[model samples]
Target: MSAARPRVLYVTDLAYPARGRRYGDEDVFLTSRLREHFDLALCHPLDATALMDAYDAVVIRNSGPVLGYQKEYDAFRARALGSGARVYNPLSGKADMAGKQYLLDLSAAGFPVIPTVDRAEHLHQLPAAERYVVKPKAGADSLGLRILPADGLAKLAGLADGTVLIQPCVDFAYEVSFYFVDDDFQYALYAPDPERRWELRPYAATAADLEFARHFIDWNGLDHGIQRVDACRAPDGELLLVELEDLNPYLSLDALPEEARDAFVTALTASLSRFVHAAQGTQEARETLIPA
Candidate 1:
């Protein structure tokens, strides 16, 4: 941390044309709010590595899909890890940050996720459905996603190589997402209409809903940063995990009430403060213990 306040390098892609969402607007709002607590600078994802070293921590917001610049992202990740730079959402995430492998792992472990299988042989593992969803393991923003008929399994034999993920197409009623900052629940929003995923409305989360979301957050084990747990209301009324978005999960702030949005910003500000201070403390301790 700086002697006065933490310096945050906020990574975002202001011009990325996200479907039905204003990536620039939300980030503009968030950084404006965060500026109250930190010395902040905004940068595009492609420029993150070159600029990251000057800041105490890097906050990756709506940076858009890594598929657009995988090599640059890989380089940023390598440099951040090697230099011990504090990255919000920490680079240790096991979910979407790492890849779609977590969905397969969670499904196999019977974690209430949509049953997923990666290979032709594993097709029998998923629940029977007329159609299935197949997507690349490393893809994001629904890129490379496909809905295929059951008979199309032959074409997916390459899935055995672990480059892709397949799940039974869930006939869900609606989708809801729970937002959290450092393992604490912040707010939730749901899309009442299944077709309009980005048309969200504020959701009154129940105890059961919080319980469902908390399980994955606890499993993720991130001591700091924001996370979003996306789940769908299955036909039987159970909430099955759709995606655990730990990397730059877009918070539909526009759908939230004023009070709720303010509260989320407060929560994030405090979380970042704690995260930066902790990293600073560790560094100070190391310096103290070093032989002078």
Candidate 2:
């Protein structure tokens, strides 16, 4: 008899029309590959909570912005944590998984992150720029983001009760993202042109670049799952942390070479297997503790 394959509920929003990326296409390709190892079923984010109980684990991937279904997402999170349901990414991400606050925290801590301040009173902390980027603390996919001149800074004061983030508009040369699976570094992609953020090409990261990107991954402390370290090369030739996406980061698998893509899939498959085995151990431990 064959061993039973673990069942995975892959959560995604197939209809989410992302600005420059095809969320549906990526998820479709990923789910197809994942089916080789697990009995995978795809579901929209809203249905995850209901369907998750039937699966061995829930894999949240390109589920679209939580802003679209914050209530339902919160409910799903609460249920998963409360019930001890296995969730890939483990629901313990300290970066974007929680919110944008990490940017400010990292900035204050003097990491290589772009300087971020949430309160208008702290506006002086930011360098003088003709414009400042104002975004919600809980924002994603650039939703609810705005650029305002210095004169408009005071108006944003009342809205900063841990609800918004402010940063000087950076005049960066380009943006690059480093992809990782578990603690292993994978390939990287970069947007050569600032206007075309999603027009990515293969990026050759140097030793220093890898070190910079790995710092946040180590800081996030996720034992398994995917992560993207987004950074921008300033005009002065220094990379500043733009965002640490440890949530449902869109992997630009299309940009990687065949061998690199295959390597990523292999790493991810191993990570998922480890995650399933660990979850099974936890379940068994709990069952052992239960009274007969």
Candidate 3:
């Protein structure tokens, strides 16, 4: 008899109307390819927690912003953690998975991120700019984001308290993203035109670029799953962190050439296999310790 293939519950919102992207087509393509390796089933983010127990692992992909279903997402996280459910990307992420708080933390540590602060007193910490960007700490997808002038700093003070985050608007030459499978680099994409972030093209990453991206990946310390390091090329020609997306990051697989796309799928498939086997091993070990 052959060993059973790992059963995976893939979470996605196929109907999500993402700006400048096709969430459905991307997820469909990925799940189709993934089905070749696992016993895969697709479900919406709201339904994942209910169905996750039936599978060996849950893979969250293109699920859209959690803000839309914050209550359900919180429940899913609590249950997954409580049950030791195998969630790809694991819940240990210290970056965007938690919230925009990581930006403030990273900025204070001088990690080449755009300076961020939640309190009005710390506004001086950020470099002076014509405008500042303010958004909710728990926000995503540019939802609830605002740009304000110096006189508009009062908005941060009137907030019920720590419910928002603030950052100075950065003028960057362009935006680029580095995609990684686990700790390994797979490929890179960039938007040459700053005004059009989603018009992406394949970018050949330099050694210094990779080093800069890897620094954050290393900081994240995820042992499995895909991560995207979003950065901008500053006026001084240095990369600065824009966001570290570890949760349901939209992989622009459609933008890649066939060869690169296939390579990414291959890398992801291998990573999932390893992650499944590792989770199975841990479960078996735990079972052995339980009283019969």
Candidate 4:
């Protein structure tokens, strides 16, 4: 059973009823492959904080939106970070790992992202459009996402400024997602029809597309973890950032060719191995400094 292998506590909800996506099936396939290299154990997200201490690292996979269990997720994050518990994504993400705040930040920084604003005063900065998208800062998987007319800003006065994000509802050609593992480009997929966001097909990313995706990956500065850079083809034939999913981004492995899926699994195994070993080394170094 390879007792020498590093053990991983894979956190995922096998039965999560995700709309338009089969979270369970993807995790089931990923876990089956991941088990080949790591001594793996599966547990639901709620139980992760309790079970994680015994494993080399905890991998947060398709656990569904954090909004469903915000309190529990907060506790888990606090405990993991407080104890230096090795999390695959490492709790160091500046994008969705934290929240959608990066979207606003990136927009203001002139990154090729859909223009976003949180306050009514910033309305001048966004392009005039018939509708706007209002989503919670902590939202995921389109949860709490709503489209409203341009005048809907008045309805949000009761909520705190940073609690919601406002962006012009764009008329884009299609959406594409670039998947990465530890800063390495794995594959790209696109939804041919915007209506079916999850009906994905393999996409051949051009060099410019890859360059656009890598910019956010490099900006994120994470040494390890999976990230999905989602963008839309604007009417101007340019890709604009939609979301930087650095925390538990779905890989859409079912949509990939067998060889691509195998390659991703291999890359993930190596990343996890390196993450665990580096964490172990750090622990050992700290122990060495203790006065015995």
Candidate 5:
């Protein structure tokens, strides 16, 4: 509404020490480029609520795991929703934005996600494997993840209580991620060796590969926002959904070639612009409805 350029409050945790990725480096590079298109200010996740009112939109980049500051994050979410602040991701995401329960929900709905069971009694439905993966329902960044032998399955019955998700440990060949912007496929990257997840290389996605990734994107139903579809290539040569990250997904722009990186930035800039415009229009509509 001001005569100045649209301001964006770029929310990120520049100090977050990720396992194999430099969260700060990527966000720095992104904000530097984004400054060219809009008036931008970088702030820590905890400060977003205090500073967001001055910006046109809040772009959540690598803000680290929300679990670290769940209470503050919840407060920020409530404020953003209540104030109708223009959030880049729009806060409508149902995946990690909410929790890991989507895995069980999708699995039960017959999605191609890895078989996930939240109840202890459902353990019998899982494939018989030597080991199983147990992770907290509210976990992130591999936190509280455990691997137990098949014999430990019964022990998990007492631990389920709907706060944990159980899945058979899959011996996957490799893990790949498909990055998208506003429902459009951007690029694919894969860890050729399962042991090193962050060592990524350009992956040439086949028609079927794109199709598989698109299924989850379509299911998410986000009209505009960035999303990452994480998947692992199973031993049987099928791709299974590992996770659908719609909330502040880290784009490994450093891994992409110069041309691809530029294209992605361009796509992102345009998307942000569209989001700002749409939000402004909606705000104006609401103002017009009120008695002036």
Candidate 6:
């Protein structure tokens, strides 16, 4: 890697045993290609804060769930935000990047998300269901997720604590995901059988499908970085948001056609280059404004 090129600290957890996904292989392929445009160093998420200073930007990719390393993740965010370190995904995310609070916020605003309520007082607002899903607000990759009967859900989450989000389990036709780079659509995938969630295949996204996905992306308002908008088709034939994963969302690139995958990489490289340049310009402007 030449010093003339921007240096990127690419973060991933190669040993993280994520179910139904090969985090290591995907990142290896991506970084190899990205290295052509920028100087790159691979590091585990645990080592990011320590090593980030040497790089022009930190790329968080396939780092697995942060639930296990909450303290470290928190420290990384605090340090990055305060120090103005350029972090891809930028840390201004309102969705899962922050937590499940936005689900309730979106639900309250009626933005096609699964109806989410975090406290006991709001239980009456939820749709009637035999069972409800309860999961941690900080959850990822299904960690700390549970399903409880209607009578038990409120008790399970301890409504007073508000640490968990509750939603009635919906019987959906299929779960579909829309991958995006900034505001641009990259590809879409779906599970034909709801029982086989990870058995994804390429989906022919309709106009409405693209519009549905873009709403959240527009809401997120990130100028750069990759995002995966996960959703499900309801029995009523409407799509509802399941998650807006801005922080280290695993891209199911292996499922895409070779051409599409290559295009995504091209888009990613350009986006990262722009992001790094923008950050550099902003840093320069800030320094110029400082008093001598």
lDDT of each: 0.92, 0.90, 0.91, 0.90, 0.92, 0.91
Candidate 6: lDDT of 165?
88
Instruction: State candidate 2's TM-score.
Output: 0.95
lDDT of 2 by residue, 1-292 (tens): 0148999999999999998888999899888899999999999999999998988889999999998899999999999999888898889999999998899999999999889998867877998888888899999999999988778867767656668898889999999999999989988999999999999999999999999999999999999899999999987899999999987999988888888888888999999999998878777899999999
- Provide the TM-score for each candidate, comma-separated: 0.97, 0.95, 0.96, 0.95, 0.97, 0.95
lDDT of 3 by residue, 55-95 (tens): 99999999999999999999999999999899998999989
- Candidate 4 has which clashing residue pairs, if any? none
Off by over 4 Å in 3: 155-160, 290-292
Model 1 local distance difference test score: 0.92
Off by over 4 Å in 4: 1-3, 151-160
lDDT of 6 by residue, 179-261 (tens): 99988999999999998898999999999999999999999998889999999999999999999999999998999999999
Off by over 4 Å in 5: 287-292
- Per residue, candidate 4 scores C-alpha lDDT tens digits across 1-292 of 1249988999999898988789999999988998888899999999999998899899999988888999999999999989888898989999998999899999999999999988867777889888888899889988889888877757744342778998889999999999999999999999999998999999999999999999999999999999999999999999999999988887889999999999999999899989988877887899999999
Candidate 6 pairs with clashing backbones? none
Deviating ranges (above 4 Å) for candidate 1: 157-161
Clashing residue pairs found in predicted model 2? none
Supply the TM-score for candidate 5.
Answer: 0.97
Cα error, candidate 4, residue 65 (Å): 0.7
Candidate 2 Cα lDDT to native: 0.90
Q: How many clashing pairs per prediction, in order?
A: 0, 0, 0, 0, 0, 0
lDDT at 213, model 2: 96
Worst 10 residues of 1 by lDDT: 153-162
